[model samples]
Target: MSEKKGSLSINSENIFPIIKKWLYSDHDIFFRELVSNGCDAITKLKKLEMMGEAEIADDEEFKIQILANPKEKTLTFIDNGLGMTADEVDEYINQIAFSGAEAFLEQYKDKTSEDQIIGHFGLGFYSAFMVADRVTIETLSYKKDAKAVLWDCEDGMDFTMSDSDKADRGTKITLYLNDDSVEFANIFKAKEILDKYCSFMPVEIFVSDPSAEPEYQTIMEEELTDKDTVIEHIVEPAKTEEKEKEDGTKETVEVEPEKKKVKILKRPVSISDTTPLWTKHPNECTEEEYREFYHKVFLDYKEPLFWIHLNMDYPFNLKGILYFPKINTEYESIEGTIKLYNNQVFIADNIKEVIPEFLMLLKGVIDCPDLPLNVSRSALQNDGFVKKISDYITKKVADKLSGMCKTDKEEYEKYWDDISPFIKFGCLKDTKFCEKMSDYVLFKNLDDKYLTFKECLEENKDKHENTIFYTNDPVQQSQYVNMFKAEGIDAVVLKDAIDQPFISQLEQKNENVKFVRIDADLNDSFTEEISEDELKDATEKLTETFKKALNRDQLDVKVQKIKDEKVSSMITVSEESRRMQDMMKMYGMSGMDPAMFGGSGETLVLNANNALVKYILANPEGENTDIMCKQLYDLAVISHTPLNPESMTAFIERSNKILEILSEK
Candidate 1:
């Protein structure tokens, strides 16, 4: 081929600047595009070799080599894959948007699928222009006696092509780093970019710095592989140590034998794990492997609760591992990373289009070669196909949870406290998931036992009918909890923030079922059944006496007779009103007074059997009567909720006066 120069096939000169600045979402994505192109090249070469169209040695290892030269202000990417001839370069490189991978797939359509190729648009090669002022490519095709070609472009619009003296059967791309992009020429920065985008690329990748002095490391021969380069061998002499005999005499003993070590050039480890754990079948993976992969990808030291391995090929090719991380606390953010990939090249993290919105609380990877990615591959093209993928993922997670509950209830319950928030969130977000996981939702009861909603309702059916009482804070509601326990009632614990909305959704789903807090109401079993007339008379007298003594005539008071003689008074908040107030607080409307909606929705219930109530009722005008009434009201208020500053101070002073009266007596 003769030396030639021509203008690029781009329509306008402004396209180069647009491609450099706005084509990709991030400036660092150029590494991903260029490295993935190399992966495609190697994959195509392997396919040809398998079909006997090209010859490749069995011992040959195909990889991508990245060399950063800070001194020279240049970065180079080398790949031992199917290189291009001069005509091929002119056709693919000279012509913008003409994808070489697409052309090869078209040529070999009958033999292979597009899954093996990572690059679809020819603009990937031009991504180098994003970080470089000038770019050059030297290559020799895999064909026998193929003439090497050298292609260079300064403005990315015009190019010069000529024959080259390059001897390798692959392509090498060199980028002259721009002043703003000089950081890419540093070895550490280059490696960081490779780790971000190419951690699981299909082809092995290695980063290097030619300007630094070569370092050497010693490795045992048993630990060496074909990838390691041996510099020299060393044999350490055996060591002797003094040992004490039974008679307390010291003796010499050989404690260690000679060891052999191989010194080799310390090369950077391969930045890519070609076969990630997600690609393997579930049956082929072990428990430890999933945990290790979770730690490696997410850098989370805490182990995951469990994982679901997704492997599908029938409808569309997809492989991944979805890990339900063990939440350490309720305050910890539930947002998790679900890395989206095409083939093995990472595209983005937490892509809600392919992963269900609820599944964003899980940490894992999903590689779907069939994803409908746009030209730059930075975002997904919203379509029905993407919806189907999201729905598929949601279904898989639901299936895993429901299956675990059915087969291994003990283990599922063990992970419930750590994983319940995720399950409840999932149920609230996805209807299909809710339908599948409804029966699997486990609630921790006050007895520290796990029970499903049906079990809870069934166990308390005769006592509370269809209502299942729960406690938000068992400590603050300990009096109510103990009262329920004394009455042989069961209350589940719903302490998580998501539990509020979750139970609301559950109520909508099950019309007959209701979730009431333990402190929301007083049970009938705690009160004696008195005649209507007598109860009305006692309620009227007690209500007037307490209201007058406390100086609050609008207070709602109820009188219950002869129920636990030691119990004096308690407060109850209406469940509906409490829920409304909570909703208001959640929406930042807590500043509004509760009386604006309805008069506090609180009722002070006084036990007629207690001596305090009896004394207050007998001597309504007595000096100590007001003190006892106010003390009882304050006690009830403190038990139910915190007392206001003024009310608390008054209550304390009144208690002290009563103690002084007792001392004087």
Candidate 2:
């Protein structure tokens, strides 16, 4: 092919301005991009060696060294990796493919972030232009007997390349900081950025020492004398005599003075760890090591309840540590807890996509080199791999939980309080994940014992004939729970905001399994069979009397004869109606819309077997009957089912009046 030489063309003169203004939100990332490029070069060289295309020397070390000089306002990153030849620089640098990175990524579409080569677009190196006034690259390819080359580019899109006499095996990039970006030249400042962004890079990185202490040597002072005039120092006669006496009589005495030495600390900071914990095999890691890693990453004082070490290589290269924190209440306080790292470097502030919203309750780090990073590494584009990774994490978490439940029931129950919200959230948000998680999702019965969904259902199937799950507002539903207990049935307490919707979805997924609110009704039909004929006859007469006693036009009342009579009269809202109210509350609505339930109001069910209801119905004319109905309705209202406050207050006043009348008589 004939030699072709041309300069890069820019679509707009605003390109440099865009790079400086909006391309990078933080100027410190420029160092990260350059250092990453250096690491990539070394990684490529290693690959070449494996391919038998090149033989690397034994003494050859692939590392990046950072030098910062505030006086000269210069920062340099030197790398002994695969350097670019003159032609390569001309094509990659002098000619900017406005869409090179995007086009290259599209061309190698099937390749994941781990497979695709870094700096394909060639703009990452130019990121230095974002913070520097002028950037220069001195490089020599790894090919046998390669000539050195120099490439220079200012903040603008223009650049120049030429042959240089400098002998270098790799590349050296020098950044001349601009007036506004002078902080980049400060060794301390540059080290901080490196530590934050490149703490686990594959290659070693070094920065200059700006905080080195000075060494001092003591020198005896000599007396000054004029030329040809020799001055002899004269000591005091008494001191001389004492010195002579001490020297003659003394055994040798040695005085040890503190040594003064200068030490070059080199900023005393590490920019990278070649091997991260997550990248290692689980067999090689211990529980204490995992816990220590968690503490280092999260800075949390409490140890993790449990963790899932995810290491997969098949579909996509993924690895991470997910910790189930000891979440004691504060369910809504989950945010910015799960961090996302690409190649061991933090990429995003919050990994919302990588971590399911439900898994936000978990706190840990997920490092996957397969996750694509843009020029700035500020955000990630969603792809099939991204979705797959999310699904994989969900399944892994479910597996860990299932194993915990099966292996250690007591410990699992101990963590139930912390993990329940996360499970409920997952069951509500992700349908597929919910299906898998349901197998291991736990429910704590009134007796404080934990059971998986399947186990709980199996245990209750024989007694109740149906898989029944119910949640109660423990304080207000205490009476309702007690009533269920009276019937020899067990109930789960779900008080979290997400529990209601979660159980609703779960009910839809499972077969013969139903979720009911404890206060929905006192009827045993939820757990046992009741004769419809007997129930209908008893409910008919009671409904008529309850309607008459309670102003029918004002109060909504329904009488049901249930097997459980411990609750004489309990107020219960239908499961459907209560769900609407919960949804309304979640959406910040002002109470549930009555129209949504077709104007169907909550009903107050009275147990026909209760003596209180029997006496109130028998002696309708007596003074006690009216007082009893009012007291019974109020009691139901206090059970957490909604009631009109006005009616409740009126009942209290009437009860006081009846008491006064009885006392007076």
lDDT per prediction? 0.85, 0.71
* Candidate 1 residue-wise lDDT, 206-312, digit = tens: 99999989999998878888878999988877899999999999999888988888999895779899999988888989998888889999999988878889999
Winning candidate number (TM-score): 1
Error at 200, model 1, angstroms = 1.0
Error of 2 at 384 (Å): 4.7
RMSD, every candidate, angstroms: 5.5, 9.3
lDDT of 2 by residue, 562-648 (tens): 565566777777776767776666778746565565545578777666788777666665666766777787777777654578876
Model 2 residue 660 CA deviation (Å) reads 9.6
Q: Total backbone clashes of model 2?
A: 0
Q: What's the true lDDT of residue 385 in model 1?
A: 85
* Residue pairs in candidate 2 whose N, alpha carbon or C atoms collide under 3 angstroms: none
lDDT of 2 at 83: 89
